[model samples]
Target: MSKNRYSVGLIIVIVGIILLLGKLGVFGFVWGLFWPVFVLAPGLLLHFLYFNRVLPSAVLIPGGILVTCSILFFLCTIFGWSLMAYIWPGFIFAIAVGLYEFYTFDKYSPRGTLMAAVVLAILSGILFGVTILFTVGIYLIALVLIGVGAYIIFGKRRSW
Candidate 1:
């Protein structure tokens, strides 16, 4: 399928699932919220495979791995799993991405990549804090905004 067609179908499925889960209850809502990890990791790898000739692999790979790990951590926490083992790896992925972006800024779209990294770092902290504090309202807001930002920034269709 064309990239645009695939992206549109993905978006429609995601939105449909979210709406269905939201109508169910807290558990469904929570599950829907953390579902993106399963969506993103392969999506990133696929993007690398399909579009590398057009866009640098470095630009998308680290961000994809970090996002995938982070989302896995969140889902684990929701399932009452202790995230101690996963946390450090996720943090490392994030830091590696940040450092990579910093060091390679001049090689690509420096401003956009750096800004995205900074925002993701800040957001990772905010989401971790809000989750730990049991701040559901703030967590939901931060989560939604991050979700929207990710879709806009990374989705192949450029929904933004």
Candidate 2:
């Protein structure tokens, strides 16, 4: 019983069960609902590998991006593809998430990696803000700006 043999056996069993369930019409109402899981599974596998020390920490970046993209895809499938217009910044955010994960898990934190994450985060915020301003209206933007400004100016003055 080698590991590869066990893994192959498990996968075959799982597929057989799924096929049997499908034939039984158990997934009739949810036939297409979990399509994103296929995309997400690899990302999860990458994370699992990193956690288990099977893969280098650098893999977290692409893994995070894949996971985030899968969630965005799922959201679009459920809500509407039109939502992508406003949520496109999520792609940038995903990259930022990957960078942050790498920084967190890597033994030697490079300055450039952290800086890249910060830049990506800022870009994502700007894109999201522009999308909101255009789609929601200027009034909400004004309110948000005022609130953010207030927080920046006064938030640190308060002692927790």
Best by lDDT: 2
* lDDT (Cα, tens digit) per residue for candidate 1, span 27-50: 666665676666556646645553
Leading candidate by TM-score: 2
- Whole-model alpha-carbon lDDT for candidate 1: 0.61
The C-alpha TM-scores of every prediction are 0.32, 0.68
Error of 1 at 73 (Å): 8.6
For 75-123, candidate 2 gives per-residue lDDT tens digits of: 9888878999989999999999999999989978687998899899999
